[model samples]
Target chain A: MDLHVEGVKKVYGDGPTARLALDETSFTVESGQFISIVGPSGCGKSTLLMMMAGLLKPTAGGIRLGSTPISGPPPGVAVVFQDYGRSLFPWMTVGKNLSMAAAADKLPKAEVARRVDEALTAVDLAGTQALYPWQMSGGMQQRVAIARALVVEPTVMLMDEPLAAVDAQTRADLEDLVLALRDRYDMTVAMVTHDIDEAVYVADRVIVLAAHPGRLIADIPVDLGRRDQLTTKAEPEFVKRRAEVFTLVRRPAATSSAGSDAELDGRPSELKA
Target chain B: MPDPSGATSTLTSAPPPPPAGDKAPTTRVPRRKRPFGRRLVSGVSSLWLLVAIAILWQVVATLSPTLYFPPLSKIFVQFGQDWFTGDPSSLFLSQHFFDAALPSLRRLAQGWGLALVVGIPVGILLGRSAVAAAMYFPFIRFWLAEPKSAIIPVAVQIFGIADSMNVFLIFVGTVGLIIVNTADGVAGVDRMTLQTARSLRISPFTLYRRVLVPAAMPGILTGVRVSIGVALILMVISELYATTAGVGYEILLNQQSFKFLQMWSAFLLIGVISVLLNVVLELIEKRVLRWQRREGLSGQ
Candidate 1:
């Protein structure tokens, strides 16, 4: 399903105690597009993803899935959380976790089993049915989390820093794994990450969010023809895009409120689409 | 498959196969599958301290024999004579065994079982619902701190020294702690796990049954073990008053008659039974908490 984030705003409290978390942010994710929202720390990237997943509500404006505004988690939408250790149930086995998502969606028992099998196989974690998630390594547990999201055959997958917890070697494997799954399932994925290269390498478009009441600073398309961990990362276009994103991310915030607003709003209107 | 987005995104070679080494460490958790020789070695190592303690007890009793502290051999003889000699047809248990041991065991089981039945659900309610917790938490804590022994007189006045009185005492002694522990366990469920459940949109009933209860089990089981000790204490204390058929009564009867050896034997019997109760509870805990241990999270 295609997703549209209208001019949404989030403030934590009322009056003077209030802190702005997200500015009037707006973006659209076409169906089957891989979009990554990248930003510095405290940039409210996770807050934005949570809003799209319908787990958190925006204080102003709204989010819509294919013309219908969602007040709660819409049908055929699944989430992959960052803290896999806490996101997956510890007492349950890997297969049971997948089955849990299916069951919660109210799928029939036989169909639940079939989808669970297919999902695990899709993640290359077949025959890991009886293993508890805690029994597995960090990478394996995150794979279980991915399989859980896939088991529901979601139209939109919202991942919040999904690979931030794993080692570098395993993170590369998982990055490739996610790319493969996105292709196989044709899933429209919106991932939030702090890694600039990772955001550019995997996403069809990188949405750079500026911090301090996060607002969209740039939306650059990644047209690098091919993506491979070994070669694609070394491509000239890939390096150039990474440098551009890095510069935007590290750009100092103007002390004057008007200056900040002008900088964010001064982008070419065509890039907003 | 059709390219749904119309992007010519050809898949690269499939990701490398999942690592096999990930599954190797988990298979070693089935402790029972160890070779017989290794099992024997562990068993002997575990029991040596107990053996050393028993030997030390025997030597001390032999060196300083008193009327209250009879020799270990004499106490053993009394214990055997009192319990081991019996009617052959009735599992070789003596009449005295039926009078004292059976009644005590029955009371413990009934009281502890009732406490569990009453405590778990109430605890879950208190743990999960803010309104319920607010209403009952302070009241439960106050009652838990009040000793069960202090209420025995009131219970005796109501039930008049019957089996009901003993059961009431045991229930009062145990149920409070269980409820507290179970509530804490439920409240202690990981926040992210609960959020995952919410995002899945599972029913409230399924959430408690599948997620909350199992997650809180380790704490509940710890409460159960602790309650067993409490139940044992209340059992003896309640049996001390107007109770004709229990180990406590036997001990009192031997004391009045100046049969120090028999009194010591009764104390020994109670000690052995307490240890046995703990062993049984530990076994249940091991089975129930197999996941915690295997995950190497806690239980160490």
Candidate 2:
């Protein structure tokens, strides 16, 4: 689905003490595109994602899934939350958890089982049907969460830093798995993360966000060619693009603002305008 | 495959040199098994602690020769002679044990049945609805603290000196606890779980049935166990104060007649029954909450 978030703003608390979490944040994810959002801590990245997922209502402005005008949770959208431990019900086994999503959607029994098996197999956890979530390792548990989302066959997948808790090696492996699944399912995925390298590695386009009333600061296409674990990070272009993105993020707004003001007043170019 | 002896010989003779990063091969002794003597001593010591208490009780009884403080041996002898013999005329069987005990058990069952029927649904409603909780909770708390046994006189006045008065008082005593616990259990379901269910568009009935009830079961069971003890206490107290039959009546009757041994037996019977009830409830709780055991520990 073509997800469009138009001038989305979220304010917490009330009256004079009200704090802006997102300031007129807007973005668009075309159908079947993989987008990653990166930002500093407390940047309202999660708030923005939750708005897009229709989990949290924005204080002002609105979101749309192909002009449907998002209100509450959209029908063809599924979310994979950060805490895998809290996401799945402790009382349920893997099979039961997957089946619950399907059952909620009122899918037929045979179809639910088939989709569950396919989703589990896609995540390389095919034979763990009866295992409870607590019985699995962190990575495996997250895979089960991903499988829960995939079983619904959602058009839009909103992942909130899904691999943040896993070890480095497992995070990389899971990132690859996400990429492979995106290709296989032809899914439109919007992921929020803090890791710059992770944002570049997984996303086709990376949107860098700023904190203190979070707003879009940089939207750069990750043009690193033929991405993989080995070649992706090793490429010279990857290093240059990363440095450029970092520079753009760290640019001093106060000094740059004075220069922009000078240029706006039609000052000569030689005066550091 | 190398033979067992050959493998050992190779291991000893080869003595592979340690790698640059390797530390010295320190021998680790397998944990020594506790000798049978030590194990036996520990086991016997635990038993002795309990036996010592029993002996102390016997010593106290033997020293005091008071009517109220009968020796444990004399009580046991009276219990065997009166209750164990086939003859229905025995004091333990005929007058004290059956005539008094069976009626009390029957009254407890009746009163507890009434409490469960009224308390459970009310508890569930109060738990789920804030408005209901606000309306009923203060009243329940007030009644719980009002010394319900004090109402036995009023109950007798209202229902007359009949089984009805006793059962009514027992219900009044026990029902408040069940209601409060049930409400608490229902309220204790995780907020996120409820949110997930709501996000999934689960119907209200299904949410209650599938998520709320199961989540609150441990709390509900706790309430039930607590109510059982209350029920037992109420049953005996009501019978002792004003009743013709039941175990409590037997105790009161024996005390009046100065049949101290018979009174003691009645108290013993009540204690045994209460413990048995508690044990059965605990077994049931373990079975019902098996899934919760590991989670409860890890959560703590």
Candidate 3:
């Protein structure tokens, strides 16, 4: 189903020193689309995602999944947080974690077992179900987090920098895992990331957000053709697109008027849109 | 597809052909077993250390018999002859074990049960509500430092020289520890977990049963462990003061009659019971925290 975030604004504190974390920000993800949001640190990408996940209520505006208004976390949305160690229960085995989510949804025992097997195999973690989270390496723990989310068969998966804690090589492997799973499940995903290459590599469309009173500054499509870790990064178009995103991200307020659509760094706003 | 055993194998294995490939289903291999010799060495090492300590104690007692030391051999002989003869008339088994040890165990159960029943809910309330914590915690803290054993006279005055006084003393001594631990455990649950549960739309009852309890379990277990020791101490102290039966009273009776051997034996019994209790608790802790060990190595 299409997810619509409608003019959601979030304010922290009150009066004088009050900060606007999100200012009338809005976006949409068509069904079965991969959308990545990239911005400078502290630009409220996480806050926006949390609002959409129904984890946090927006001070103003709202989010909707098709016809249903998201008063709180939507029924079929699963979140993969960065700290896998904290997100999954330390007392449960990897298999139990998946089963718990399935059981929570009141799935039958047979269905839970089938989904558990499918999720573990999908993440290349089939045999390690009996292993505890701490027994695995950092990358493996994160995969289990992904597996847990997948077991729920969420329609819209919200991943907040899920690969930020892994080694460089492992990060690339997990990125490919995401792509493979996306194709297999036909799932809609909204991932918040600070990595420019990652945003361009994984996303069908990349949303560039400005810092300080965080707002959507650019919405660019990344048409780098078929993606593989090595081949996609090697493409000249990949490098060009990443450089464009970096430039838009680094644009200072002085260069662009507050209300006008003046182009920054001589690159037309058309490329961004 | 076969499950890789180690990091090296996993890295070398081709990423399993995309999910659609018609590869045979993977089977998991059994984990490698530790070498028998290594397992034997670890098992014997722990027992050897205890044996070494016992031998050293025996050597010291044999060489210098003057002061207050008894040889390990003599102690064991006395223990075996006194308690395990299967003789119904034996002082150790008949009078000491039945009359004294059983009474102490009974008193301990009564007091600790009361403490748990009263302390846990109160602790949970204080832990969850700041106003409740602020109002009650200071008074509780003030009482914790005061010697509950010194109130034996008051207990006797109120409940008389009966099981009631023994139970009262244990409750007074141990309830404080239980309350403090329970409150800390409840308060220690991570804020993020609570937020996650709330966002998941978990019902209030399920939130408490599943999230709050599990999150607070380590702390609660710790409290239970600490209180067990406290309960044992209070059981002995209360019996020593006014009770006519129990291990503590037996120790006092033997001391007064100049039966030093019997007094030492009673003390030994208490020590052995405490150690055994602690070992049982350790096993339970290990079972509960098996998953905890697998969590990423953050500082304890």
Per-model clash counts, in order, read 0, 2, 1
Q: Write down the RMSD of all candidates, one decimal each.
A: 5.6, 9.7, 6.3
DockQ of model 3 vs. true complex = 0.27
User: Which consecutive 10 residues in model 1 chain B have the weakest lDDT in total?
Assistant: B1-10
Answer with 1 or 2, whichever has the higher TM-score: 1
Tens digit of per-residue lDDT, candidate 1, span B101-217 = 889989988999999999999998888888999999999999998988999899999999799889888998999999999999998989898889878878888998889999999
Worst 10 residues of 3 chain B by lDDT: B20-29
Pairs in clash, predicted candidate 1: none
lDDT of 3: 0.78
Docking quality category of candidate 2 according to DockQ thresholds: incorrect
Best by DockQ: 1
Best by lDDT: 1
lDDT of 2 by residue, B141-213 (tens): 9998988789988999999989888789888898999999999999988776775565555567777776788
Question: Predicted chain A of model 2: TM-score relative to the true chain A?
Answer: 0.91
Interface root mean square deviation per prediction: 6.8, 14.8, 7.0
Best by TM-score: 1
Compared with the true structure, model 3 gives a TM-score of 0.85
